[model samples]
Target: MSEVVLITGGSSGIGKSIGELLTTKGFKVYGTSRNPEKYKDSLFPILALDVRDLNTIQQTVKTIIEKENRLDVLINNAGAGITGPIEEIPEAEIKANFETNFFGPINVIKSVLPQMRKQRSGLIINITSIAGYMGLPYRGIYSASKGALELITEAFRMELKDFNIKMTNVAPGDFATNIAAGRYHAPILNDSPYQKPYGNTLKLMDAHVDKGSPPNLMAEAIFNIINSKNPKIHYKVGNFMQRFSIVLKRILPDKLYEKLLINHYKL
Candidate 1:
């Protein structure tokens, strides 16, 4: 039987691309959306799911298992973005981002584990961000939330080893997606101390996303991972510079790397 796959936040963007490609490859794909009705024309079924809502997460998983009898792969691609100066960002927004980007995926994983363990086989691929590897000036909150997910996946992988289940994190660099449209942006207050710098960073961030690589690259990478016998703990999909930045952080001194980012962002 073909692998049964579930991709959260799959109504559009990277998740949509992954789901579409996998479906064409003969994998049974179900994508999730908060408003499933809006995506009636989606190539794959769009199950109603809200990552921040435990009840919705549980029901969605149950629905899939009831129909498919098994869920062979889970792509935890549901997440939100927030961009603002750390101090200026409201506490509520920060927590909200964590709810969607961090705790949300954890709950979804928990909901699916029982069935996965019963089958003694499964693969969970978390869609994290390249920014998760390090703090970015204006997108600090997004970085922290995704970074937390990355670390937790490392621990989760070890915990799932005994159950014959595999867990991995796939961090993508800027992709041409609608994430920017949905991201929360703190107002660029004319009198606020960070007004000029924050505004400039925001513009640069948008430009990067506009010029980002195709989302299908991520789909191809995930497809390969699903077919592999031993998938790595972490996989990164992006342009050379974006992937190299992670390596540079490892080899460069803290301050030197900070300087490079500062210059890159023109902070």
Candidate 2:
């Protein structure tokens, strides 16, 4: 029997690409979206899901198991981006961003753990961002949310080791996706100190994403990770500069790293 794979935020972007590729490779893929009807013509099955809603997550996973008998992999790709000066961002907006980017995935993970434990084998992949490793000027909230998920994935790896369940955090630098269009922009005051810098930096960030590597690169990385006997705890996917920047942040001095980021974003 083919392995069953579940992917969230699969209506479009990287999630959709991964779903299509996996389906072609013979995996029984089920992709989730807030409104699956919109993707009625998707190559694989698309289920209605809202990661923020625990009831919906539970029901969807239960439906998958009832039909497939097993879920070999769970890909947490559903997330939202919030961009603005950290100090200016509203508390409500920050909470909502975490709701989708961090807690949503956690809810799904918790719901699937029981079945994964019973199977004694499973793979969980969380799609994070390069910003999670290093804070970006205007995208602090987004960085924090994804950073939280990355840390949680690490803890989960250790806790699930005994159950033979594997987890990985895949951080993609940037990809041409609708993420920018859907990103939440925090309200900026005309007199705020960061108004100009925030606007300029945000533009640069969007431009970089416009030129980012295609989603297929990410799909390829995920495909390899799925087939590996033992995948690494973390995988960074993107162009050389983007992936190398992570290493630079690790080896470079704190002040130097800050300077590099400032210059890159023109902040």
Candidate 3:
């Protein structure tokens, strides 16, 4: 029998691309969106689910388990982007971003764990971000939220080892997606201290996304991880410079790395 796969935030962007590819490969793929009604022609079934809602999270998992009998893989790909000066962004917005990018994924994982444990064979892949590796000037909140998820996956892998279940993080760099449109942007305040730098940074960030690699890169990377006998704890999918930034962070001095980022962002 083909393996059953569940992907959160699969209505569009990276999640949609992954769902489409996996379906073509013969996997039984179920993708979730807040409103499943919108995607009437999706390649795979799109169920209604909002990661932040525990009731929906639990119900969706239950629905999948009831039909599939064995849940084989999960892609925790539902996430939101927030960009603004750390000082300027409201506390409420910051909390909201964490709710979606960090806590929501955790809840989804928790809901699926019981079924995965029962099956004794499963994989969970968290879709994180390259920005999560380090703090970017205006995107700090987004960085922290995704960064937290990355660390959580590391701990989760060790905890689930005995159950024959595996967990890993796939951090993608800027991808051409609708993420920018959905992201929360703290308006540039004319009188704020960060106005000049934050405004410039925002433009650069948008340009990066507009010219980013296709979502197919992330989709293919995920497909490979699912087929591997023993997948690694972490995987990064992006262009050379984007992936190399993590390496630079590890090898370079803190001040030197900060300087590089400052120069790059023209902060």
Candidate 4:
């Protein structure tokens, strides 16, 4: 029997690309969307799932297991982007951001872990971002949420190793996706002192995303990870400079790394 794979936020973007590619590779792929009916024409099955809702997550996993008899892999690709100056962002928006980006994946992981442990093997991939490694000027909340997920995945790797379950954090620098359309914009007051700089930084960030690598590259990387007998704990997918930034951050002095980010974002 083919391996059963579940991917959240699969109606579009990188999630959709991965689902399509995996289907062609012979995996039984199911992609989740808040509105699954809209993706009825997709190559793979589309299930209604809102990762932030625990009830929905549980129902979706239960449905998958009942029909497929086993789930071999899960891709936590659903995430939200929140951009604004740290001080200007409202507490409510911050909470909502974490609900989607961080806690949403955690809920899904919890829902699937029991079944995965029963099977004695499974792969879990969390789609974090390059910003997770460092705080970006206007996107601090986004960085924090992804950073949390990245660290959680690391801890899960250690905890699940004994169960023969694999966890990998896939950090993509930037990708052309509908994520921009869905991003939450924290309210910035007209008299806010950070307005101009925030605008400049947001514009630069959008441009970087527009020029990001194709989604197919990410799909290929994920496919390889799923097939590998021993996949690495972390995978970075993007252009050379973006991927290199991770290594640079690791070796460069703290002040130097901050300077590099400031210069890159023109902050």
Cα RMSD, each candidate: 0.5, 0.9, 0.6, 1.0
TM-score of 3: 0.99
TM-score for each candidate, following the candidate numbering:
0.99, 0.98, 0.99, 0.98
Per-candidate clashes, comma-separated: 0, 0, 0, 0
Best by lDDT: 1
TM-score, prediction 2? 0.98
Q: What is the Å distance of residue 45 in model 3 from its true position?
A: 0.5
Q: lDDT tens digits, residues 184-267, model 2?
A: 987666898988888788788789889988898899999999999998989989888989999999999999999999898777
Better of 3 and 4 by lDDT: 3
User: Local error of candidate 1 at 181, Å?
Assistant: 0.4
| Candidates arranged by lDDT, highest first | 1, 3, 2, 4
Residue 120 CA displacement from its true place in model 2, Å: 0.7
Off by over 4 Å in 1: none
> Tens-digit lDDT track for model 1 on 32-128?
9999999999999999999999999999999999999999999999999899999999999999999999999999999999999999999999999
> What lDDT tens digits, residue by residue, belong to model 4 across residues 174-266?
898878879988656679899788888878878888987889999999999998999898889988898899899999999999998888877
Stronger candidate by TM-score (1 vs 2): 1
lDDT of each: 0.96, 0.93, 0.96, 0.92
Is candidate 1 or 2 superior in lDDT? 1
